[model samples]
Target: MSIIAVVTALALSIIPTGDTPTVSVQQGAVQGVQAEGVAAFKGIPYAAPPVGPLRWRPPQPVQPWSETRAADHVGAICIQPPANGDNAVGPGPMSEDCLTLNVFAPEGATEPLPVMFWVHGGGYVNGSGTADLYDGSNLARHGVVVVTINYRLGRHGFFDHPALAAERPAEEPAGNYGVMDMIAALKWVHANIGRFGGDASDVTIFGESAGGVAVSQLMLAPDARGLFAKAIIQSGVPQGATSRLDIATPSGPPLADRGASFAALKGVPADGTAEALRAIPAEAFLDPAPNFGGGDLVIADGRIVPTSIEDGFARGLQAPVPLIIGTNSNEFPWARADTHPMAQALTPEERTALIAAYDDADDFQGRFISDVMFNGPARWLARQHAARGHPVYLYSFDAWPDAMPQPHRGAWHAQERQYVFDTLSTSPWPTTARDEAVAKVASDYWATFARTGVPAAAGQPAWPALAEGHEEALVFHNDGVAVEAVPNAARLDLIAALLDRLKAAGLR
Candidate 1:
């Protein structure tokens, strides 16, 4: 067939054939099969190869192809240290040429659908948009266009150097080249989503864990201001960024600090530390300590971040968009347990030290960790956003089937995230019926929000916002979804106040 005929046929296949349909795009095309009436396009490249000199630099626009590019298999993941256990290959030998994205769109999509750009979470050090748990297929079938992207990771994505900066003085960025890559993807979306039948206006950006933190940063970024409209942050970070002191903001304490800023990364050799960072292989830069944490996340790099995110938000500098945010019931539990070198059952003495931190009379050590990590921080932020009168919807995914074994990772961090993206098969959870049920419910709620800003799903219990102190908020409980007074409200409040006092005293 001629190129025009091939392109025309591909585009036509994307249209509905009564109940059957598909769609095509440039570079390649997708003839999507309908799942509840939505079409999904998988694994599309958004930028030029990050290989060669582009490895540590900001992403550049994708090279346009003469023929439609086929997007069937997932692109290779951004370099990420592999999962520590069973899956540990330490990001399994990555390439500098990894800048790909996936898309999901409504079937027979002619009009511009609302766009929901998602950034995945791997503590800014690990994770890929291709993790079976993040398939945007089912999500696109829900009447929106979902785009998940890959950016540089660890040293390959976030490295800093003085030579490169001096070389690109007209385009010098402080670091956080990964975050900048995300912004570039959004800009690409804004420029090209129309061709994919996606609406540029009324975009809703959302993510969990590190991805949520990325969304939070996007909200604070002056450069990212007009790129999105609404945002959903599932267990996002409002604070606790490391080595950001190295960033040189136009104002404020440069995002960089100590000897680790992008400037420091740049100054490593010039400042005489180059022998250490450069002498080592790039992959060696992945220290095990941050253990998928943001110790190496976006820095203050004087450019994109401009200043501390909290300071920026405090100064009313964040994008004023509707925000839907929440956390699972067991974030802190796994954070402590997983990051440790030795996974030992806590001894009585160890347990006491753990529970003592919370001043709790109960023996649930898990609760203490959970409280400190997510519950404490999440409740405070919900209230703060509520005070600002931003439409904030808070939820707690406390439900896990009783059948899942002991030392249960009930609704743990990144656990609910799989469900939200409708990628249950990607997870190794015990495949009990309860797991399936929870996954469906969670996916439904997520899709509902992507469809409408509110996370209301039918046949489930009514989920109220944390807006009023009067109305109960949604709780995904063992008893199925319920509306509660923000689970353990009093304890959460105490933790919040305690942290506040400690912060005021320069202690926390």
Candidate 2:
């Protein structure tokens, strides 16, 4: 049936159905579920599918339809593997018809709601906004319009070619299509959110892991200016994390050469790369033989992503907006150590040796992973925003064993998702009575931050704006909120220097 028909029928069915009053928007209408103080609409399409010839090009406006598209079900994820995290969500369906988003807002017939655009994290290769971890219901319950979006991923989204660019001189550089998708979503929000009771002027863009990197990089994109009023960076920093084809210079294997690699694959053709990749089964593409390790997809396209975010932020170039950021105390243990039971049970000798190898290294090897993977980037973001004379809040999730599920060494990568959303049942983290209380506190703070510029809460400790040298940030732990300076500051500084040099060398 036509989407118009579906929407009309849906609208007809909503004749005073208890609480959730079905509403209409420019494209069509939706009957959202309402509870407490929030009204939610899931699977809303903000842009047209960039399929066939439109592939690799910038996003276009949503198709003008006579009827509303049925957004009850999430749109298919960009043609990529499903999330296989420590909690692997098995492979599911795929489609080019994947540009869709979801939203939650406080129920009110009129007036604009503050916007919180959420970007999910999956290392830029795996994951979707449809995941349970990003449920915007509770957040909307806190009084802002919360949105989660799915963008292109992996080979389908990041493949770049000089031929492709030449074919479309009007377009941005090919890789970072996923990032372009996000900019498109923000634009969509800017254009149509008011009809849904959202304030386009108060948008706060935020995300975790790769998503955090996306928000950070978006700061550098000229096109993203003024789309958001604030930013909440989680675990990502834009450093050497560029698309293979997007790098202007490189020192890796022969494969790093854009000309050479494309020349070698010339027989295959560029536009057809997507088809070739699709022809290969999902499992095979998950990891190729020589193993480049899931193939990083967020390349440094010259157009949408003009420069590296790390350099951009450090040069006083990030979006001048209020910012909030931080990471769990021991996120690596989840990404690395948690995968191995024995590793988590590090013997005294192992712990000592591990600490020795890392304890003194500038920022330690683990610190590099933590910083690049999630922390330092966050700190850098907080600093840049504060420098902009905006109120920037920095935090550290130190809830440790009390917040995590299973015996954990400390706060792990995804451990905060559940807490921030007050969702512990679904996340893999160990949850205790303390965990529940902590999660409530965490979610409450995030909601309050998104609602107003302040992350204040009732009976909760006051979070202070970040001050340079005075690196004091909020530490959310079982002991309740406390103020603590960013630990290992000197070590992180050393790690940053080493990484700058290594990235300069391009892994040679």
Candidate 3:
């Protein structure tokens, strides 16, 4: 068959059949499949495919389709580094045309339910919303609509070159294209989620790791104002601010300089035009990819990411929305307690007191790094947000998998994801009765928070909001849950002091 005929046939096959759930979004009508009391619409295009000349540009409006497009299976994920042995890969093959989102809502619900928009984490280099671990059926059944999105990743998602900027000429912000994709997705949800039985006004943006960082970014972006009502940051950074767009930061060179350096490595001429840069194959950018281990994933482009997350919150410029933020107890169990840049700012007495506070020398490094990097920052952000008169709830995740047996020191990074999504069945480690129980409690807390402003779970302890005098968090462990004062206050205080010193010295 000819190319046009083949395309027509495939499009016709996707037309809604009898009993298939259909919803009319602004772009067009879509047919979704229903199972287990949930209506799942997959591979829904929210923005135009970023390909060829459109590459590196802000997401454009999705072209309207005349026929009802099939929303049964997932679309291709954005081009990213291969996972090798990692299991966090998304559902489809990798491609540049991957700006779609997935929606899961309770089937046949009359009233509009709360909307929970999720952003996946992969160090800003990998990951997609279509990962099995993010299956939203269970969470949707809890009386909420769940939406997960795929943004630009790696160079395809974030890049800044003087030539590229000149082409746009003060149009959209340069760099931070992935973040722009996110805001476009949000605008789509705000406009069309109601047709899917979701309350657009009650949307909550939640994410893990880099995704959590994005939640904070959206809270700071001026274009994202009033897009969401609540925010949750799971394992997000509170101190490590991102690099500036045109200006150098303590972290590294400005994004424009980095982009030029990358272009030089790619053999682009000093006076190369934007067309020459765009002509380079996408795969070429991956062979000698920019160091993925460090922090250049997103940039503080003045238009999109107006300021660093820490600076935004510090300046009280972030949206005064309800917040839930926390980190895992043992985010890095293998980190050795050794010299650090921040440690250089500590005095001998202060360093001794900090070490003595953690108690166990064998696990000193793990606990210390966790406190300074994750726990302490989480508490600090919580305090800042709470001080703004907005409701804030904090928590610590300390549960271990059965595979990692006792004297458990590993709540390791991102371990709470399975529990928060109630996706223990998809866990790589063998789960026990306690694991399932913890998943229920953890997922309940999250879904409950999305449903209402406060988090509450049946048969579990009430989660308290952070206040001036009383600061407590809902601690999730293997056995059960508890609400206690934020753990290791002295250690966190020392970490904070050291970090403040580092910032003062222009090293952070």
The candidate maximizing TM-score is: 3
lDDT agreement with native, every candidate? 0.64, 0.66, 0.83
Residue range 147-179, candidate 2, lDDT tens digits:
889887765566555446555565345656778
Which is the winner by lDDT between candidate 2 and candidate 3? 3
The 10 consecutive residues of candidate 1 with the worst lDDT sum are 250-259
* Candidate 2 vs candidate 3, TM-score winner: 3
> Which digits, one per residue and each the tens of the lDDT, describe model 1 over residues 1-508?
3342233334434354333333444444444344565555555777888665565567776766665455555667665665654221123335556677777666565455678898887777777776556777766666678888887776666655544444555766746878888898888777656555676665788888778878878888778988887888788767644335344433233322322443333335444443344444445444453232364456765568765656765666677777777888777553443333211334456445545654463424456656766676666666666677677778888866554556755776766765666655655544566666766787777767766777777699766766665746677765568777777777666556655655676554
Q: What is the C-alpha local distance difference test score of candidate 1? A: 0.64
lDDT (Cα, 0-100) at 355 in candidate 1: 50
Off by more than 4 A, model 3: 1-19, 240-242, 292-294, 405-409, 505-507
List TM-score per model, in order: 0.81, 0.81, 0.93
Residue 54 accuracy (lDDT) in model 3: 87
